[model samples]
Target: MTTSSAPPVAPAPETASTKDPATRPRRRGRTGKPPSALLSRAGVTALLALATLYTLLPLTWLLLSSTKSREDLFGTNGFAPGDEMHLAENLRHLFTADDGIYLRWVLNTVAYAGVGSLLASVFSVAAGYAFDKLTFPGKERLFSLVLLGVMVPGTAMAIPLYLLAAEAGLVNTFWSVFVPGLVFPFGVYLARVFSAAYVPDEVLEAARMDGASEFRAFCRIALPMLAPGFVTIFLFQFTQIWNSFFLPLVMLSDQDLYPVNLGLYVWYSSALSQGHPEDYLLAVVGSLVSVAPLIAVFLMLQRFWKSGMTAGAIK
Candidate 1:
């Protein structure tokens, strides 16, 4: 009478989709052959090759041109190395000529770009985070002003900015380049994007509720989250300041304060008109040297950009 065995557990029901054998992954086609993966791989390889060539074109030209002397620049194959290797000779001329003035120009460029971008990044992050999370009067209006400033080309404001600097006795000085660079509208905009994407509002609120001051919460919690954004802003501002020629051209008359770009312009102009045509090699080499640091920076810090985008996307 006690032979009641537990009823067999009902077989687990399969979903309609799972029950269809045709829906299963197949290892072979109807002809007992594997699918061709070459087309997709070939397409990707071709695309990568094209992209590599496109990006390397300018750098290739710079490299080849740097190797050529005045005569070889036009006389030899545009992409080929010259018969004589004068990189050392050209560099010697660059450093020794004019009592080592090129070194001064290099220092000035470093000062302007390195220091200015650092300060600009800080200002942009602070402003951007404030705009994103903090409530204040006319915040939107202020951000709108920044947007308007972005639309207004830097060249358009060059005269006005120079005049303002002149009035303040800042023109033709290091301040003329560094001070103006610190006010980066595009950096602010990028910072705002990063802040919005990465820094969560709730985290700030929770920190505040725990008796943290506004500044304390930002410094402790939000600031760390914004590292990626800050890095991006720094890189962008760095590049902008590094490549800036026209602003320093108009604002500063002192050769000692000239950034590399403006300094290179001087060399190019001198080579063409007043100086030896052989100096053309120096100009090309100088141009190449000016860009090398930026290239190094990009290569070194590119991971931050990728991480920032990933973190922002996940947030």
Candidate 2:
């Protein structure tokens, strides 16, 4: 009985790394430190600094140049601050000239870009959702036309849009510029991609089972899923419409309805061609004023914009 009791012994268990060193991950250094990064820290910092300088150079020039009067603009050094910093005077002249038409131009830009982009986002999302979830004849054909539209430059459509506006008696009115910015084909395409990727079919089916109409189901169940996509499309359309020039040039004749870009262009042109070189400073200041809203908008909505762009890539 004593001999039998001594017969049983347990063997030690082999852990993963001990069993297979080749398959196991490499360990950290003796000090438990990670390996060197791809880029040296100092080298990476220097690269970023150079990039920052490259981007800021022009803006820096503009800032310094705006501070100069017309005389200083030509007479003094271009990059350095002039002796008489006339930024306040330049701004005053900018708003006061042409009976304060610059304010009207700014307001017109808001209507054309801000309001138009909002409407475009809604239409895009709705059309995209319908194209994805609903089955109808000619749906693919219609969507193909949309894809075709994206390849055509907005400039190429200006004459045709102008012709259409003339037919509708909308020429030279706010509606001329406001309406065109609202019809972005690429936005609809992007919304479709986001819809198919984000909105779940099973949830929509359940909403249908709960006696919800198609519109109600979309409004209640799907729109919230598409909100991020809307923000992305809105921002894109807003910037496009905001920076637009030729479309408004061809569509509108009333300077009172000009967007800031077109208005500054007229000023810069008149200043250069008409010998009122003093207005050049006004043009520079207006440019800075125009850029401020875009910067503010990006800063405010960048959180949603970043998330929206990356959402469909994951699922």
Candidate 3:
């Protein structure tokens, strides 16, 4: 009896496999509520399709209409091709009308948009660089004032600009339009944003430490880095100046000085008032031609523009 006591048995420790099924915690799998109708992939694709259609509709109409005769332009459906293609005839008429004033308008547009955009980009970049990297008194206040200018519509500023031009004896002259195009407040804002995003302080510091002057550093180092931004600013300013009608309308009386947009308007107005169907055709063709440069510029610089837009988006 003294030797026969059984040793106490130890219970086995519980493990996952040994646990009761009902007592084990449920794991989370990939399960959730469905996305909303509007946010669904199908919905997003549909919206993009609609937007593309909306944007291309007018351009499609313009292309078809340009191929039509004056009679077909009014008679046929906007999207339909004309019975007879008259595009060449229309272009010839457009170029020859009013002693080839359309060509003058095209050149004027080129000069105003091209040169003005370039100059504006340069000035804006310089000012923006100064605002971002260089410190001075009243910098924030000055920038705030510039931001205010961006809020003001260009149309609202036209009258004041006209008054200033008149005071300077520059109204109805090329300089009136050209000078105003140079001072793009929005471009300044864009340049500052681009400078902050693209141009690094350390790079400038390195250049400066090497005894490079501020202006030299800007030209040699900062400017090349800001190339994409420069092109972005140029394209924006170009489009604005190219399509600018109100400013030129207020500032210019001479037909020779008209940009393509304003010139087209004048032709359309005269066509309506004078009962000239040919002028209507000319306007249409001129409009088609007017779009070419914009398309070309965008196509050429789109790579730079894309890079500029995505700069600093991630970091």
Top of the candidates by lDDT: 3
Model 3 clashing residue pairs (backbone): none
Model 2, 1-315: lDDT tens per residue? 355456667888988877997978888878897766637688789889999999888788788887888887888887978544388888788889889999899999999999999999999999999999999999999999999999999999999999999999999998999999889899999999989978888879888999999999989878888888888899999999999999988977789889999999998999889988867777888997888888888888878754643245334
State the weakest 10-residue window (summed lDDT) of model 2: 306-315
Candidate 1 structure quality by residue, lDDT tens digits, 1-315: 567788889988998667998887677878998766655688779888999999998888878887666777868887887544566667777788678877888889888888889999989998999999999999999999999989998889889999999899998888887888899998889888988888877778788889999889878887788888888889988998888878999987887778778877887888889966756677787887888889988898888876753344333
RMSD of each: 7.4, 6.9, 6.1
Candidate 1: residue 285 lDDT (0-100): 79
lDDT score, candidate 1, position 51 = 95
Tell me each candidate's TM-score: 0.81, 0.80, 0.86
Instruction: Tell me the tens digit of each residue's lDDT in model 3 across 1-315.
Output: 367878999998998755888777656446755556788799999999999999888878788899998888898888998644488778888889889999999999999999999999999999998998999999999999999999999999999999998899999998999998898788888888888888878778888899999999999888888888899889999999999999999998999999999999988998999888788888888888999899999999988865653345334
- Scored by TM-score, the top model is 3
Q: C-alpha displacement of 115 in model 2, angstroms?
A: 0.4
Off by over 4 Å in 2: 1-54, 82-85, 308-315
Error of 1 at 228 (Å): 1.0
RMSD of 2: 6.9
Sliding window of 10 residues with minimal summed lDDT for model 1: 306-315
Error of 2 at 218 (Å): 1.3
Looking at model 3, residue 76 earns an lDDT score of 81
Span of ten consecutive residues with least summed lDDT in model 3? 306-315
